[model samples]
Target: MSPAVPIPEDVREEVLSLAREGVPRNEITRRTGVSTASVSRICGGPDGVSFDRSATAAAVQARVVDLKAARIGLAASVLDDVQLARQRMHGAEDNRAFLDGAKAVAALAGTHVRLVAVDKDDSSDTEAAKSMLGKLAQALGVAAGEDADQAEDGGVA
Candidate 1:
């Protein structure tokens, strides 16, 4: 068996300092010639250190859930605004502009909905956003469907 390596007091302090400075444990091990496992033990291990990986991960997951919920709420609100805009454009001559704005709002709402779905499914937020955006764009093409030609030329009834 290899002899156990002792981390000197000064080296320990340096490692702790580097950890506090946001250097990763692996990097600290490389710089200090300490074993990666030892460095982790000294800086974040159960008995020697205060860092709690499980707690940190739980907190991050909670935050993500909160953010995703907020995104969904914002999307719903925008969709409501779009509906109101459509209602207000009734009997108005500028139906085209109003309908265009409503379409934009719907697109944004669809994006947020997809984002929330992604979060619910445990996908990365960035990836979810991109996927949702693509889906929203495609969905928008069929948004008006059979009403398209009529809505474009005819004012809201």
Candidate 2:
């Protein structure tokens, strides 16, 4: 048999992290420049670490909260734009300018409405994510207060 090739520490860690995040073995191999057999060896069976789904769930929840905040901010900006467009439409000096301003108002208003529709109170989901994250930290022997503080400060732990 040929001598075994030693994978780099960084590459091995990258494979492990990708696998934990639910990346397919082939995808991890492609991303990390690791061989398929090596990727499989690093991410499968008893010798391999199982996927950390709790981490993924927590990440997704954090992302959702961030997206909601962004949407609310975008909606506010769109509303401001709509107001400006309406003013411009009313003060337009020509038919073409008036039509352009009116179209801008309509488009901005529609965008604002869609953005507002996506903004919601996800307090329950936030709480659940916090709870799950705390549990995961506990399982990993980490201090819960540290992560809790991070969560309260709007950072994902």
lDDT of 1 by residue, 1-157 (tens): 9998688989988888888777766778889988888787887654354433576689999998898778777777766765766566563468687677667667766765675566464557669889999999888877666467667878552
Q: All candidates' lDDT scores?
A: 0.73, 0.84
Please report the candidate that would top TM-score against the real structure. Answer: 2
Candidate 2 lDDT over residue span 37-99, tens digit each = 888788775557665468669999999999888889989998989999999999999999999
Query: Per-candidate TM vs. native?
Result: 0.41, 0.47
Q: lDDT of model 1 at residue 136? A: 94
- Each candidate's root-mean-square deviation in Å? 12.8, 21.5
Clashing pairs counted in every model? 0, 0
Q: Provide the lDDT at 77 for model 2.
A: 91
Q: Which regions of candidate 2 are displaced past 4 Å?
A: 1-43, 46-51, 119-157
In model 2, the worst 10-residue window by lDDT is 44-53
